[model samples]
Structure formats: C-alpha cells, structure tokens
Target: MNTPYKNAKLHDCRDAFTATLEALAGQNSDIVAVCNDSVGSSKLGNFREQFPERLINVGIAEQNMVGVGAGLANGGKIPFVCAAAPFLTGRALEQIKADVAYSQTNVKLVGISSGMAYGELGPTHHSIEDFAWIRALPNVPVIAPADRAETAAAIRWAAQYEGGCFLRLSRVGVPDLLPDDHVFELGKANMLRDGHDVTLIANGVLTHRAMIAAALLEARGISARVLNMASVRPIDEAAIIDAAHATGAIVTCEEHTIFGGLGSAVAEVVVDHAPVPMTRLGVPGVFAHTASANTLLDDFGMAPDAIAQSAEALIGRKG
Candidate 1:
C-alpha cells in the first residue's frame, strides 16, 4: 500500500530467481538444475558451480533436456528444467506434455528470457506463445512473477509444490512491486493499488507498466485500481469478479499475445461472472517487428500512456 516504490530502482528478476533456487537447493539435496545449453542465459552458473554434477546440460537439445528432467524426477530428484522460453515451449512441447505434464512429474520448468525479452533478436526468439501452449495442457500450473520478490517467492513455491509448473521469467529489468517477504499464493491475484473508476490487470513485465498506467489515469482524474494477476491458468477468479463489480471497467495487459494470454484469461472470468467493458492490450495477432523489448511494448500499445488511454475509452462503455 505504500508508495515507496513509486520511483524504485529496477532489478532483473533472474538474479533473485537463481539466488532463491540456490538457497533452496542448499536445504534440499534432491533439488537439481537442468538446461538445454543455456546455463548462462538461464542464469544457472552459480547453480552449476555449487552443484556441478547436479547441473545437467543437454547441449542444445531441448527435447532431450526435458526428457532428462523427467527422468531425474522419476529418480526422486527435483529437477529445475531451465531454458529460453521459445525453445523450451516450442521445441520440446511434446516432451513437456508427456514427460512432465501428463506424467505429473515434479520437474520445475523454468522458462527464462520469456515473452519479448529477446526483443532485438526478433520473433523467433520471442516467447509470446508459451502461455497459450503450456496452459492448454492438463496438469502444468502456469505462472509469471512481476518482480524480483515475486520471482523469489514463486521459485520457493515451485520447490515445495509436488507437480510440474511453468515459471515464465523475463530478462527485462523492472522496479520492485512486491515486498521482500512476499509469499506466493497459487491462483491468487495481488491488488497493488485500489480505486473505483477502472481496474488494470497484468503480470510479468507488464505489471509495473499497469501500475504506471493506474498513476497516469489518476493524473487524468480517473481513479484506477491495479491487480497483478500472475497465475494465468488457475487465475484468481474471485479477484476478477471483485474488480468487474467494483470498478465496472477493466483493462488487461501482458507481454504475450492478446489472443490466449493474460487478457483472454481475465476476459473469460469477467464475461462469465460480471459483464464489464474491457480492453486487452498486448501484441496483436501478428508477429512482432524487430525492436527493443520496451519498443515492442510501445509498438503494441502497451506503454503506460497507451494503457491509460485504453482504460479511459473503456470507461465510456461502463453502463
């Protein structure tokens, strides 16, 4: 509720992610790191250094890497399968579905550099479709953390959780949105700021952007509430209902496509529980052009000003 983080310095969530994983690994001997030749990119260097034998690198073979992770889990080891999101979800999807999801393995699938984090490298590296692909599966719990604190908390949760889960993490630096001691609750949305005019919902890199959009709306004399809806699959439906009935207008933002990502998930809840005017902001149904991550976000009308404008327009439809 405090605004001390209004101008907070930015942090890359991967730092907190690996640090927490390492700390948990120290306590649980069964915890291990697995990767598809992405130890550095996945920020697992310290993990490899501390547990060299435990770091399994499959040399660019994502399918084999996921299979090995399943095998480790079957062998009673808690494997943290790490890789770039695009390849992890795209290349090894079948393996993930069969070995991890269908079998209900205890492998923690960590998708690093998710969404548009590799923005300059273009769409092939962009992981915009991961949420849709993974969330469609039966068993995996889909999650994306807003900042370093949430990333740490989610990692801790995954370590304790019994089945497979996808952790969507980005390399883009963001200011702290949650407290250091924040606890991760599965399928629960965190209300960052409260208001009455409209509600802005988002996760991952977009959560901070939503907060800024809420502030922009405030400056325009529109009271905006912000919700960090991190878990996409088992979404916080109760929060979505509260937002729809309380605010009457809702705006959902994400780093993924508007088709099947965070926005669509929230829309399903809003339409089912309480009909409300809504605006979904993200990459449209098109391949993103070459640019930096922030540039791509701005191009897709997800910048704070753009989100605020969308919310303002949607408020007109609230009846």
Candidate 2:
C-alpha cells in the first residue's frame, strides 16, 4: 500500500492555503489575511511581507479576531481569518454566528492546525468539535480538503464564492489523495476508489488513511470503495446512498470527533434513505491526551491498519 509519505513531494495543506491566498490577493486587492498572532503558524509571513498593511493581526484574541474579520467583510474586504482551530471555533463561535453567518458576511474563516494537528498540546489545542460547531451555522459551508491539490482548489473557490465559509487547514502533512488538478465542488463527494464489498469514506488527513485501509482490504480479497468527502455541510447524499445500496456496509474515518463529524454526517444520510451496517472511526468522544497526531489516530483506532480492521468487521455485519 502506498502511504502518504511514499510520495516524494509531501506538503502540508496550510502551505497551499497561504500560497493560494497570496496569489489571489495579488489578483484582487480586497483579499486580506486576519489572524490572532498566528502569522508564522498559519504560513502568512510571506503574505504579511507582500502586503503588510493588508495583514491584520488581532494579538491572540480569537473573539475579537473574528469580529474584526466580519467588520472587514462588511467594508468590502475579503477577509481570510486565520488562527488555531480550537480557539477560532470554540472561543469565537458567537462572533462567527452573529457577525458572519447571521449577518451573511462574505468572510473566509481559515482554521489552521485543525483536527488535532497540535496533538502534543493536549485536548485544549485540539479542534475535534469544529465540524459540529460550524455545520450548525445556517449560511456557512464547512470544508476540509483531502490533499494539497484539493486544498488549493478549495481556496480558489472560496475566494470566488461570495458568502461566509470555513476552510479547515491542518499542519499535518498528507499525500495527494485526489488528482493533481481536482476541482473544488461545493456539496460534492469525490469517489476515489471503486469496489462492492464495503465503502470507506473520509476527508482531510483521514482520506489517505481510508485509501490505505481499502488497499489492506483488497489484500484480504475484499473490495472496498473509497470516497474523498471534503465538503461536510452540504454532503453528497446521492453518493452516500449509492455506496450504502451497492456495498451494503460503510466505514467512515476522520480526524475530528465521531459525534458530529464526517461519520455522523454520513450516518444521517444512510439512516434517512438506505440504512446499512456502518462503523465510525475517530477520536471516540473524549478529549485526547498528549500525543503526536499520528499517535492519537492510532490510539483512537483510526490508524490505517485499525481502519482496515474496522472495515473488515463491518463487512461481516453486512447483509
């Protein structure tokens, strides 16, 4: 099985985001980067150097950072708010709701180092609850790109889109899960690998893991379909239901909590249309202890091998 590291050129999605944002900013002067003293972590140093005046740093106050982003958007500026995922989503949730979503502001909320990217920093730094928090908002579209290619595409699309949206960026390095030129489609799920035994759905860092799981399943004479579902809010219901009907079983994995993340989103579609046996792999439901991101994934049964085993178990339950 080809792992993420097997590819010669490995890239963190955050780099792609910053590069795309800077390039877009050159084309449109309205593009701006708003952060809470996270210029280095968010890879906005180049952006700041290029357009120092356009980079707005709010000095670690996540709430005020989000509010300022909203205000910037109201003033005809395309604000790309960048900060740690945990604080950006948890602390500034009210501003995100009232200033961005409720007010229909065209702000691009960029959550860097999201989904346990700062694993050694403990649960306080983890952003497992981001999916649930952002998905609940009415007008905001929650997106977690599967690879650097998808990340760049999503960034371009977000720049062109005229509405409030959240781009969940991770510092974790991921291999190319989608084609090099994959286009970003809102509310659409990309089918990566095709099979009939069981379906494996994932996004972000977990998408490559799901592909590895499918390879493991194939070795054991099991054919598993793989879906790279980047868009969490307007989920692809038709693709999900097709997988349920064809495979009869599904296994979903993500870097977020299983409660209201990708798994929960898939289960919602399955239970509504084509109910099937399924397994959701993620950070169970508890705050994660101090560990590296990969270690945390292994501890939570989301490692490639564990994901394969979970898919095998689900196949047994398939009718």
**Model 2: number of backbone collisions:** 0
User: How far is 272's C-alpha from truth in model 2 (Å)?
Assistant: 0.5
Model 2 alpha-carbon drift over 4 Å, by segment: 1-8
Question: Local distance difference test, per candidate?
Answer: 0.93, 0.92
CA-RMSD of model 1: 2.2
Which candidate comes out best when scored by lDDT?
Answer: 1
| Residue runs of model 1 more than 4 Å from their true location after superposition | 1-7
Q: For residues 156-239, what per-residue lDDT tens digits would candidate 2 score against the true structure?
A: 999999999999989988887677688999999999999999999999988888988888889999999999999999899999
Estimate the TM-score for candidate 2. Answer: 0.97
For candidate 1, write residues 1-319 as lDDT tens digits: 2133446888999999999999999999999999988989988999999989888898999999999999999999999999999999999999999999999999899999999999999999999999889989988999999999999999999999999999999999899889999999999999999999999999999999888888888988999999998899889999999999999999999999988988898999988889999999988989988899988998899878898899999999888
CA RMSD of all predictions: 2.2, 1.3
Model 2 Cα displacement at 172 (Å)? 0.6
**Per-residue error at 293 for model 1, in Å?**
0.4
For model 2, state the Cα shift of residue 261 in Å: 1.0
